[model samples]
Target chain A: MTGAPLLAVNNIEVIYDHVILVLKGVSLQVPEEGIVALLGANGAGKTTTLKAVSNLLGAERGDVTKGTIEYRGERVEKLSPNELVTRGVVQVMEGRHCFGHLTVEENLMTGAYTRTDGRGAIRDDLDLVYRYFPRLQQRRTSQAGYVSGGEQQMTAIGRALMSKPKMILLDEPSMGLAPQLVEEIFEIVKRLNEEEKVSFLLAEQNTNIALKYARYGYILENGRVVMDGNAAELAANEDVKEFYLGLSGTKRKSYRDVKHYRRRKRWLS
Target chain B: MADLFFFLEVLIGGLLSGVLYSLVALGFVLIYKASGVFNFAQGAMVLLAGLTFVRLTQILGSEHPWDGMFVLALAITFAVMIALAFAVERVVLRPLVNQAQIIMFMATIGLTFFLEGAAQGVWGSQVHRLNLGVSELPIIIGDVLLPPLDLVAAAAAAAMVAGLAVFFSRTRIGRALRAVADDHQAALSVGIPLQSIWVVVWSVAGIVALFAGLVWGAKLGVQFSLTLVALKALPVLILGGFTSIPGAIIGGLIIGASEKLAEVFIGPLVGGAIENWFPYMLALVFLLFRPQGLFGEKIIKRV
Candidate 1:
C-alpha cells in the first residue's frame, strides 16, 4: 500500500462446472516485491484465488465468472497460464506436484520451456537454484517422486525459480511439512523475495508463521475474504487470534461453562 | 544344415516384422504417455496415412519412384499429417481438456471410427499397391536368405526410433512432454502449454503412422485391412507396457518372433493359422503375471 500495487484482484468470483460457486467477489493486492499471505481454512478458496491469478482455473474446470485480475497495471486474467509465465508470473501449486517420473534436475529444466534465453542462462539459473536449496542439488539426479516431501517442495519452488519469474503464486507451502521445515521454507521465500525482487502471494492455513513472514495478510472464510490488515494488526486482533491462531486473551474456561462454544464456532463458519 | 538355415530365415524375418509392429506401437505410446489417452485412432491413423500417401503418390507420379514425385509426395503427405494434428487438437482435445481419462479414451474410440470413415470417404475404399522400390525377393546370404524388403523396413524403423529417442532426451520440449506425462497440473503451472504439447505429440504420432503406412502398405497392400495390421500392435503394446519406448520395441520383437515361431512350428500340432491369435494369447497370459507389463510404471499404492 505504499506504492501502486504489482497485482490487483478486483472483486473476482469463481464457479466450477458452471453451477457450484466458489470465490464470491474477492479482491486483494500485492505491492512490488511484497510478501502477501492469503490465510484461510481448507475450503476458503485460497487455492482458487491463486489459480485464478495464474489462469489455471480452466484446467480444474473452474472459471472466474466475474471481476478482473490485473498485474503490473495490465488486465492479465484473460491470458493463458503459459503466457502469464512468459510475462514472468508462475505458480507453485499446492501438494508440490513434481514430475514423479523425471529426475529433479529434469523437472527444473522443464520450467525453462517457454524461455528463449540460451542454455548458458538456464544453466546459471539451475546453479542459482542449487545455491538456494543445496539439498536439491544433492537429490537432483534422483526421481522426484522418490524424494522426501520437503525436497519435493524445494524442487517445486526451485523449478519455479528456473523460470526466472517476477512473481510466484504459492498455494499451501506448509500443507504437510513439519513446522521446522515450514520455517525453513518461509526463510527461503523471504530470501527469494528480497534477493530476486520477486513478489509473492502465498496462500496458507498456517496464519502465525505466514503473518510473521508476510507484510500483509487476508483471512478468507467460506470463499470470501472476511478480514484483511497489516500483518501485525491482524495477528493482534482478538478474533483472528481466537479463531485462526488458537489463541485468546482469557484463560481456558471450564468444560461445563464453554460446552456451547461450539455455537460460536458454527456461527463464525 | 538346411533346417538350421530355414530356422534362421524365419527368425530374421520375424525380428524384422517385429520392428514394423513396434513402429505402430510407438505411435500409441507417444500419445498415451503425453495425454494418458490410449488413442484407439492410432490404427486408423496408420490407415489414413497410408491412404493419403498412396493417393498423393498416384496424383504426383509413381513411375520414376526415385527422382520424381515419390519424395515430393512423402513431403506433402507429412504436411497433411501435421495439419490433421492441428485440427484434432482444436476440435477434439481442447474442448475436452479437463474431462476424465475415460472420456478422452471414448473420444479416441470415436476418432477411430471417424478417421476410418473420413479417410475412406476422401481417398476411396479401393485397395492400392504401394511399391517402396525395394526388392520383395530374398537376398541370399551364404546359406541363409533374407527378404530385402524386410531389411529395408527394419532399417527405416530403427532410424525413426533413434531419432525419437534423441528428441525425447536432448530437447527442452521433450522434457516438457515428460513433465506433462508425470503431472498435468504441475506442468501447466510451470508454463508448459498442454495444448501445444498435445499437438506436438499427435503430430509425432502422425509421423510414426506414416512410416508404418509405407512399410505395411508395401507388404499387405494399402487396403482398409492395414488397420488390422495396426490392431495387431495392441498385443505389442500390452506386452511392452503402454508408457515405455523400449517396451514397445521389445514387446514388438517378442510378439513377432513368438507368433512366427508358433505358426511355423506349433501350427501343425495346433491346427493352422494360430499366428492370428497367438500374440493375443501370449498377452492374456502376460497380464496374469504382471498387469503393468515389462516396462510400464507400476502404480504406487500407499498403505
Candidate 2:
C-alpha cells in the first residue's frame, strides 16, 4: 500500500432541499489498498456519506453543503457521477441497481463505457469477472432482473469492477443477503482487497463482519463520526461493543452473531 | 363473383393508398423514436409542405414546370423544414423537456394549431393541383392497369423506408438516436446533444411529411383537408409499436390493405365510410391483446 492516501474526505455537511441538514461535519480518510468501514444505525447518514463520495447524492435529493472530497489530490466535490466514474471513483450503489432489462454482460459493459480501451481488454476483464463468480458466467446471457439476490449482489460488484475503479464505495453490501451468502460476499470483498489491492469504503450495518475485514473503522451517530480509530481498537471498545457489536458479558459472539438491541435498554440507564 | 376484377382493382388502389398512410406513419415514428413525442403537428406539417411546394413552384414560374421545379422547390422546403425544426426544438421542446410527458404531448398539439394557423396565413386558403410530373399514362399488364401515380407513391414510400433503415443502422448519428430512444438519461450522460437530436428528429419528420404531401398532392391535389390523413397514422402507430421502423412499414401496409379490403367488401354492406374507421378499429384490437404493440418492448416501472 502507498504511504499517500488515495481518498481524503474533509468535513462535509449535506443539506436537503436547502433546509433540512442530513449530515453535519463528517470526515473520513481512506488509503490505497485499505478497507474503511462506516458503521451507523439506520438513518445515521451512512448512505448519504457514500453518496457524497460517489457524487450520487443529487439523484437522491441531497447536496453537499460544505467541504470537498479529494481523489489523487484533486478536488472532486462538484463533479458529476459520470465525471467521477471516469476519474476512477465508482459506487456499487445501496440497492442492487442493476439495469434490470439488460443482460448480465450488457450491465457489465455499461461499467467500461467510459473506457476507450480495445474490445480485447474488455473481454479479458469480463473473463476475469467470471472467474471471480462462476455462477455469473453461467447466467451471463440472462437478464439481470431475474438473477437471485446473492447473484444480483455479485453482479453489481462485478459490474463496478469492470470499470477497473481504483476505489469502490460499497453501500450496504450485506443489506439483504442470507447469513451464508453474507459470509460469502464478505469473503469475496476480503479476497478483492487482498488480491486486487483495491481500496474500499464500505458502509455496513453488519458491524461484526465489517470490523473483521476493515483495517480502520468510523462509527457514525446522527451524521457525526463519534468514534474513529484502528479496527481492533474500535471493535474492542466497550461502548462500541454494546451499541454496535451486539456483544454482552465477557463471552463475545463470533462473526454472524446476532443479538437484538431495544431502544428502551438505553432508557433503563 | 362477376365483380372479381373490380374487387382486385380496388384492392390494388387501396394498397397504393396504404403506402401513403405508411409514409405519414413513418414521420410519426421518427419523432417518437428520437424525442418520445407523438407529434400531432405532423398533420399540419403535411398540409404546410403541400402548400409550400405549390407556392415555391409558382414563384419558380410556370415555364420551368413542376418536373424540375418540384425538386428545386423541395430543396427550398428542406431548408425551411430545418429552420422550423430548430425553432420547435428551441422554443417548445427545450423548455418543456423536464415537464411531464402529458404536458409535452399537449404542447405539441398546441404546436399543431399554431402551424395550421401559420400555414393558412402564409399559403392562403386555396386548393392547387400538384402534378409530381410522373406520367399520367397507366401501365396495362393484361386486364390490370396500374396508374403511374400510384406506382410512384408506392415506390417513393419503399425508397424512404429503405433509406431510413440504412441510415439508422449504418450511421453514427442514427445509432445515437436509437440510444436516445433506449434511455434519455443514459444518452445525455454520454455527451449527446439532446436538444440537437430533437431538432434533427423533427427535421426528418418534416421531410417525411413533405414527401407524403408531394405524392398525395399529385394524386388528390393540394387542399387543407389533406391534413386528415395524419390522423390515419394513429392506427399505424398502435399496430407497429411507437419506435420500430419495420413495425411502421408493416403497420402501414396492414392498415392500407385492410382499409382497402374493408372499403371494397365491407363498405357496401355498412353504408361506406368504412375506410375512415377500419385502421383505427384494427389498432384498437391490437391494443387489446398487446398494449406495447408488435415491435415495442414491454415497459416495467420501478417505484
Candidate 3:
C-alpha cells in the first residue's frame, strides 16, 4: 500500500435493472505497477466490480449506485468506457470478445485506435506483443473466429497491449481454456507485468493460479469481500484453502460431503 | 442474328439499371454496418438530395448565367447532405443508442416519412429534371445500341464502389468502421467512440444517397416516385443479405438483370408487368436455398 494506488474502489454498490443489487459494498485497490487478483466464484460480483471501474456497467442496464471509483485520483463514475480507455485504463471483457470477422492483425490494430502515435511506434508495439505471444504472429492473417480458443485469448490480450495501457482489467482469461493453456497464458501475463510494468486487476475463478501470480488478492463471496491478504497469506489461510483451493487436511469423500460438514459457516460468523 | 443482338441490348440495359439499384443499396449497407439499423429512409434521402440539387441548380442558374453555377450547386448540395447527416445522427440516432435493432429499424421507417414530407414541403411536389450534362442520345455500335446515361450511371457506381473499397481497407476511419461493423462492444472497448462512428457512417450513407438521387433523378426526374426506389432496394438487400456491401452490388445486378430478362421472356405468359414482383420472387427463392445470402458470413451459434 505504498505510494498512491493506480485504481481504488471504495465501498461501491452496483444495482442491475434498478432493483437487483449485484454488488453490495465491494472494495479493492491495485497499486501502481502491481498485479491484483479479484478471486470469486460465479455470481459473486467480481465482473461487476471490474465493470464498475471500467464504466461498462451502463451497457448492461447496471449502475454503481453508491461509492466512488478513483482512477489516477479522478472520480470515474461519470466517465464513459471509451473515455476510461483513452486515459490509459482498458478492460478485456470476458468470453474473449474478438472481432470475429476481422483478421488477427486487424483485431490487434483496433486496440491502437485512440493512439495518436506514428505508424513506426504502433508497429513496434505490435512486434512487442508478437514477441510475447509468438503464436499470434504465425496466425496474424487468419480471421480471429477461425483461430483456436487459446489463440483468441492471446489475441484479446495482445489487442489490449497494443493500446499501450497503463493498467488492464482482465476478466476470466482462463475461463474455457485447458489447464496447460491456462498456465501458459498466466505465465505470459506474469512476464508482461514483470517486463512491461503494466498493472493488472484480474477477475479469476482459478484461485490457485491467480494467487500464484497476484501480489495481493481479495476473496469475494455473495458480493462482499470475505477476506483480503497478501497472496502467500491468502494461499495459506484455512478458509480459502478449504473453500476455494479445494484442498483439505484429510481426503474428503466429495465436495458435497464437505459442504454438509461445513453447514455452519465459519466465515459468516 | 437480329434476335441475338436484341438480347444483348436488353442484357446490357439491365446491367446498367442494376448499377443504380446498387447505389441505393450501398446507402443501406453503410448505415446497417455502422448502426445495425436497416435504414428505410435511404430512398427518401435520395429523393431529398435530388430535390436539393434540382432546386439549387434552378436558383443558382437563374441568378448567375455562368457555367460555374452548376458546380456551386453541387457543392451546396453536398453541404446540405452533410447537414442532414449531422441532423440524423443528433436527433434520431443519438437518443436511440443500445436499443433493439428492430426499434432502430422502425425509427428509420419513421425517418422515411419525415424526410419525404420535408423534401416535398421544401421543394414543392412537382417533378423536376436533373441534368448532369450527360447526352441523352444513344450510341450505336454496329447492330447494338448503348444509352449514354446508363453508361454514365454504371461508371459512377463502379468508381464509387472502388473509392469505398479503398476507404474501408486503407483509411484509419474506414478500418475503425469495419471494426465497429464486426463488434460494437469490442470497438468501444478499444477507445473508438461509437457515436462518432455512427455520425461518420450516416454521413457516408447520405453521400451515397445523394449520388443515387442524382442518377435516378436524371433518368426518372425527381418526383414522389423516387421514394419508391427505397422499396425496390429492399428486395436487392434480401437477395444480397442485409450486412454485406459486395452482396448489395451483386444482389442489385441479379435483381436488375433477372427482372428485365423475365419481363422480356416470361412477360407474355404472365401477361406482362412481371417487373413489379420478379425481384421479390427471385429473392424469396434465393433465401429458401441460402438464408445468409451470397457473400454473407455464415452465422455460427454457440450455446
Model 3: share of real contacts kept? 0.60
Q: List the residue pairs that clash in candidate 1.
A: none
Candidate 2, residue B178: the lDDT equals: 64
Chain B TM-score, model 2, reads 0.94
**What order do you get sorting by DockQ, best first?**
1, 3, 2
Worst 10 residues of 3 chain A by lDDT: A258-267
Instruction: Quote the lDDT for B266 in model 1.
Output: 94
Q: What's the DockQ for every one of the candidates?
A: 0.76, 0.14, 0.66
Candidate 1 residue-wise lDDT at B276: 93
Return whichever of 2 and 3 wins on TM-score.
3
lDDT of 1 by residue, A1-269 (tens): 88889999999999998999999999999999999999988899999999999999989889988999999999998899999999999999999998988899998999898889899999999999999999999998998888888998999999999999999999899978999999999999999999999999999999999999999999898888888999999999878887888776778656785566632543356
Q: lDDT per prediction?
A: 0.91, 0.81, 0.89
TM per model?
0.97, 0.75, 0.97
lDDT of 2 by residue, B144-166 (tens): 67788888888878988899888
Lowest summed lDDT over 10 consecutive residues: which window, candidate 3 chain B?
B59-68
Each candidate's chain A: what TM-score? 0.95, 0.91, 0.97
Tell me the alpha-carbon RMSD of every candidate. 1.8, 5.3, 1.7
